[model samples]
Target: MHRIFEFDDIIRAVLQHVESSATDLVNVAMTCSRLAGPALDILWSRQSSLARLIMCLPQDTWEGKVEGCCRDYIVRLSREPTPIEWEHLRANASRVRRLVSIDGFTDAPKLPRGPVLRRRTDGIGSALDLFRPILRPDVIGHVLKRLFEQFPPATLFPNLCELHFEAVFGLLERSSKFWLLRQFISPGLQALRFDITGIPTHEVEQLFAALPTEAHGLRQLSVSAGNGTAALTVPPSLGKLPKLIRLAIFAIDVSLTRQMITNIQQARCLQTLKLNLCGTSCDASGIPLELPSLKTLYLSEGSLSQCTHFLRQVTTRQLSRINISYRGSASPAEVTAFVESLSTSCQTFEHLERIYVVDKSDHPDYLLVIPLHSEIFRPLFKFKRLSSVKFIGIGNFELDDRFLKDVPIAWPSIQELKFISWKRRAFYSVTFTAMMSLAFRCRSLQTLHLTVDATQSTTIPRAPDGTEALWPTQTALRNLHLGYSRVSKVARVPYFLAEVFPTLWSFKFYERYLRNCAADIDLRLALEKAHSQLGALRNSPYENSDKLWENDSDDSGT
Candidate 1:
């Protein structure tokens, strides 16, 4: 018994690294009765599919194995498929705490939606594949209904904590499906993820309305319109989930934004909200929604101004993190206005921690420059608590050294910083002293990414006594990625970088030159090899290895 417990501990350790750990535990359960109970308990704790578990039953349980179809199915019902003789399933059913429905992949040349797909099983495999639940829409609906009917009760999975269904709305919205679902809406259920693609808005609304009132423990709900333009209707019942904490909506029509906002406003304990292409129609009312507990909000792909408009309506003073992304070309003025509005609204948030701004425009000719030194970005500097900031521009954006010098004062807590520009030259050359000033001030800085010119010849920054100015050594910085600007001496660049960031274990020089030059190519390759060598040297405990540095220089032929 002690050995069994010890082996169970090993299984727990293995589970942390592998998603198939439950399956592995199940295999171990088959070895002995002593191990079976505990192993099965863990194995059946979270099930991605009920069919997969059902298939584990003996061949006798299968009604009749017929050959023609890709997979097998229960043609005849026996004893209404009760919990008799199936000891393994009956014993472990109570352990199934999660149910996730797998999504189907339509192959090339999508078949027009109809019964035409049910007749064509030319390349479809056998019934054993039903566990994956990826079948013709009609077949999926039928099999799921049959399986749900055969499912025992909440007693089988008494502690089910989460229910996740992906692209399985056909089965979920079936007239009889709610009765089966009601069995699993135990008080222990804390999360619900439903992806209702192609399902009409009315059906989705009905599904939400059917949710059990006893869902007090439910804290997280993520729903997305699967793959189509179906604007999912937000059921007022969503606002009624007592402990609801996080909500995410994706690819929903703009027309429903008003109802969605109202639904979110009612969730008392909501902490995180994510909107991805969720709205089309912008609400002109700009009504304020009070959400004191909300801490994080992410917006992507929707109308940039509309998203900001929604943000303007929220009074989440405790909000700490904000991520906003625009997929298409957005005017700089509009983007700047959004930032300015956010900065003004959250000016009093002393706990603001991270801000990530991304412009995902694909147009090469378009460039959106943000002058950090100008009044447009002045409001952003008010967040003194910022730890991580990422600015990914649409094309190119200039970042002057004068503006960078104040980064430490603006966000002294900054640890991870990324400024990505798509232009050939986006950052003006800064004296090594000015760059080191940032390192000196921001002691906790670990990851830094920027692009700049390094080719200009200038006097080394020194003190009045003519001694080279020294900055405090930054021990936390481990990764540095700098855009390759022209360097007067290519060989000296790495040494300069090594001096600036002595603790770096990963250093990458990125140069985006339109027309590639052979000498430039050679220089980059050599620098890459040198960076690897430096990384290895830094990782090594033995520091006094002049021979290793010599060997690296020799290899680079410098």
Candidate 2:
């Protein structure tokens, strides 16, 4: 004879199991058919604090397919309802707040009149004769216009701290009361990202003017322009925002940036600024180089000459972080000149090493009159305090002897380094083992990321030596991201844990480089296993949950 555990005891154990595992309950179910029912029940029956119930409103089934899933769940709950079921459905109101974001405009909810009417002859028991008349788009539009006309002292949605909208609503020549985008910023928003592509300039100006100072005084504002400079303008009212801090704008004309920064500087709280110029020219009026409080600044996809010139004007005394992307031919003299201009406070802050220049600028595009290995970075190695450096589009420059030898000189105080290239693709002549051995000598290296276009190699490289020590290390090296399999030697990730460096914290061992792909259960399990293995090193503990981001579309297609 056998005795069954109490239902409460079973639930407690299941909850504990779900909590401890850095994986999904669905993955746990897939491990064993016997565990499937209970594990799925745990995952589905439990409602997320922020989203809906997985069992009742299956995320996959939310897009108007199977019209009455919610009704079905109601039936199931009413029939065999357990204690957990009740807790999921009613206890969490946020989980049940259905979001029906419009593609081009806005609309409000209509009151429900019991079950949905299916028959044509369904009589005077209609939705029209409801407890109160439900407002339609036009009605709400008129009412909101009158309300805004009044200009009340306060608004609602106090809990609304962030508003990240991606300009899904196509623009019109004029603003409509129906387009109550302002209302969306319930409480004063702290963070806002606007995808203002294809919007007319006057409309942008109108909206900017209409927005109240306190309503969306966003501390962090990222504007991605699809059309061009027309989407961005430094509103006069922006200067009055109390807590505007971080600003990140992408795909806008660089000329518009100066006005935006001028407006930002008026706000005493502005700190971090990032400007992304994907395809536009950097001839924008010019960055306001004299920001008193600005500390961290990132300018990507601009000519390095422009960057170096811009930094020369700015006072880098308080600046801590600076990231510049390669866009033009910047010579070794130019890079070293900029480094030489850096305040001693910015450089030797941690007192590590001499400063240096690492220029892998390939061109006709200016073909190297001076070889990349010798003329460029070698002289700058004398001043080694500069720790960080980046190289792009250099597939042929594998960890060759000359290439490998340059690393020690370029990054003397280097603690963090990232290399994304096609290493295995072009390094056929260089033996993989020797290259690996050379890379292991960097004594001060810590976060290292090397991703190859593994699509270049058929399999891992098998050298005369048993295996390439891909992750060889003896220093405090931590955080390894070796993706796209460079060689056919190791069956799996090599020296990823303490064997490489003891203090390694974060590690990403991606099998395939697929972005926004449908998540597979096995792949998720493997990722969780790899993520959890960081505990073997002295790393931060990770929790078992998907990083749910609030994407622009209400539909979770991507």
| Index of the highest-lDDT prediction | 1
lDDT of 2 by residue, 443-519 (tens): 77765545332212222334578774344455667555543324332322233344555555555644433344454
- Model 1, 1-558: lDDT tens digits are 446456757655644443344444444554555555554455455554554444544434443233336543323323334455355555556776656443211111111121100111122122111222323222234545555455555666677776765433333454554455555565687877766655456666666765537667777777766542444556678888878877766654555566667777778888877677554566555556677778887777765676667667666778888877766655667667777777645636587788777765455343344443234555778888989877665435555677677889999899987765545345454543455566657899987766555554433457889897644467888766665443444334455556666877656565344248786786466545655556555664212222321121100100
RMSD of each predicted structure: 9.8, 14.6
RMSD of 2: 14.6
Model 1 deviation from the true structure expressed as Cα RMSD, one decimal place: 9.8
* Range of the 10 consecutive residues with the lowest summed lDDT in candidate 2: 549-558
> What does the lDDT come to for candidate 2?
0.42
**What is each predicted model's overall lDDT from 0 to 1?**
0.57, 0.42
Error of 2 at 98 (Å): 14
Best by TM-score: 1
Show where candidate 2 strays beyond 4 Å: 1-63, 66-156, 167-178, 197-203, 209-212, 227-231, 256-260, 278-288, 326-388, 394-413, 418-444, 447-475, 478-558
